[model samples]
Target chain A: MQTPASFEYERATSVEGAIASLQRLGSGARIIAGGHSLLPMMKLRLANPEHLIDINDLAELSYIREQGDELSIGALTRHVELEKSELLARHFPLFRDAENVIADPVVRNRGTIGGSLCQADAAEDLSAVCSAVKAKAVIRGAGGERVVGMEDFHIGPYVTAVGEGEMLTEVRIPLRPGGGSAHEKVERRAGDWAIAAASAAVWIEGGKIADVGVALGAVGPTTIHLSRAEELLRGKAPSEGLFAQAGEIASADCSPSADGRGPIDYKRHLASVLTTRALSRATARALHQEA
Target chain B: MHVSISVNGEQVSREIEPRQLLVHFIRETPDLTGTHWGCDTSNCGACVVQMDGQPVKSCTILAAMCEGHEIRTVESLEVDGQLDPIQMGFHEQHALQCGFCTPGMLMTARALLDENPNPTDLEIRTAISGGICRCTGYKNIVSAVRWAAEYEAAAKQEV
Candidate 1:
């Protein structure tokens, strides 16, 4: 039987209360939102925090809304909500696409977006989706709040910009005009982690690509933000040829190690193929050619 | 720590370690052994239960986190010895082989039907995608959920 080591549990009623407890408990404390990722790690003895500050009761931190020009998603928002949010679907269908394939419905009901991002697993789909959408992380500490871009939010494997005495409060994706996003993943079976997944977002203006974001998951230590591919796609007209070239970049760029999912060559091949598919679908949606 | 949780509409309180998982708590505290504990990694759905009316894998949830929440186990599906329509459907459709995956499958399907009275075959398959049934190859399980949906719809019309 697998079980976590004995630890003190504290339930936080408010965000401030949770932060205060985090500060007091210092590095020994960990904030558990959905407990899906954290509890599993705890059971394996991979994560052994001395104290767990439960934030599940902070209902105030659960929301997804349009705040001015950006979409603000509360950190405590569950995966089920992300998958079902029509507002999100209207803006970024990639969320729903990725959520559909990320684990199963029952797990989605209990898993939170905040926890998923914080877990910082390389195979996690949301990190790639967030990176592709240029989402910003809003981290709250006792001093104040600081916003970090997706590139900086993830520092290493299973590591994030969320400091020891802080917590991720919200994720803000800048709403740009003429933008469409899609996520594509290939997994071995239902509810399995991606062998290689790609998330692409394209903003078109006057039949030309104004801006683009492309990222790959499960093919690297952290989300592989395809800056080279984005640079190549920028200012170029959307075409099969341009996307094919971008796929080549993805194949050459990602750093994947062989494991149960696939070998290095297979994952690299998937990275390329999935990136092209995502880019094609995203562009089609941007031109209002596809739903 | 002392944890108090509502299991099948009954409040059960017990003194346990903070790290005790909900699956063990449900079985050992209220002695509701119907909720099986399968994969400790949360991959297997044998440990599924309803928390606040939504299905969650009990093996990964700490009992301490469920202190104030309402948890419904497989034992609740049969009240006054009258099986839930889902159970009846399972029996009629022969949805079980080893019976190990039945409890979790029933709870997961029950939650899905509660939220969606009539789900398509694709929807039923998607709803129970988390569960792994080594027996029956899921053909009869899908039929069982469909049968339950039809049964409930017919019952509603008769009423």
Candidate 2:
């Protein structure tokens, strides 16, 4: 008997049209892409938007391609596409890894990256994956579009930088040479949210770690950036010892509360172990040691 | 709101509340009750149906959102009194203990076989991972999908 509260629905013909609907409807209006996340929340009465602007027909906003020095992923790109994209697999294998475990294949077919990120659930994987790769979110509104870093994209749990009249249009990841990325997650069962997940991206130069990004999911109110761990890994040579030290930082930094998934201590432990494994795999790929 | 959707290749129009889910629409509008509504949440795939040839959880989708899209329910699996290979496989393999999860399983397996004519046991398991059988009849269900895969592959070869 779960159902959303009564609301007006409109199909947007174009991105501009969707934005116009949102602007006209004001704060109560929500842009629904894929509707996997939003509809579930609506059913539970956790979300009660007065108007829903369906953006599923905006096929022009569905793509994954390389533009200039970055990889541009259209916000409407379905999770199935992300999981199957050889382009994404070749450049950022972490996307494939995260997508593989995001949900069951059937659910993935209907879920979109934009909706996943905009939902801003701490247990969701893509937000942590995007944070680890230093991806920038492109938000479009009736006025114009603005790009925001992943760190700033999430305001809090279930809150995003996408404003009243705005929607996320794309995510841009800067393509750097000698870079590799990987994601690791531990969940209780199939299609379940992560108890604790870690995503790591490493760029090696001269046999040393030139830059690194490490983030954790389901371990905090928002995606944990792991600046402490990143700072610890920078300039260090790829080694098991260095990664183990970084894992310690991840374990210490994340703030996880106890729930059905696990206790706080267990989640912290998972954060550490998953971080080390992700870093190890990422560095191995960066050095071309593993595919 | 008035919503028109192609259910089983036939246009079914109705005046439903915008909040009405696609599963309820399918059952109440066209009287296609083969698609069960379970878990009301998306966790249980009992409400699964094919949208534009891909399996989606109908319980999580709004009827308003399905306007103009083609939705195939479990009832579509049988045409002219001939069951889909997936349904036949389910029958031969005894895939259902209670039959509550059968409709969703059939549609999910049908969509998987349509996309991948030959799926390994692991692939079949992965494809239906969204579904939960309280009876825990997954072993037979996986066998049913594999049986259907082989049946379709062999049928295509003969053609």
Per-candidate DockQ values are 0.92, 0.89
Fnat per model, in the order shown: 0.93, 0.93
After the best TM-score superposition of candidate 1, give how far the Cα of residue B156 lies from its true spot, in angstroms.
0.2
Q: Per-residue lDDT tens digits of candidate 1, residues B1-159?
A: 998999999999999999999999999964699999998888889999999999999998999999889999999999899999999999999999999989999999999999999999999999999999999999999999999999999999999
Candidate 1 chain A: minimum summed lDDT over ten consecutive residues — where?
A: A35-44
Q: How many angstroms is residue A204 displaced in model 1 relative to the true structure, after the best TM-score fit?
A: 0.7
TM score of chain A per candidate:
0.99, 0.99
lDDT of each: 0.96, 0.93
lDDT of 2 by residue, A193-218 (tens): 99999999999999999999999999
TM per prediction: 0.99, 0.98
**Clash count per candidate:** 0, 0
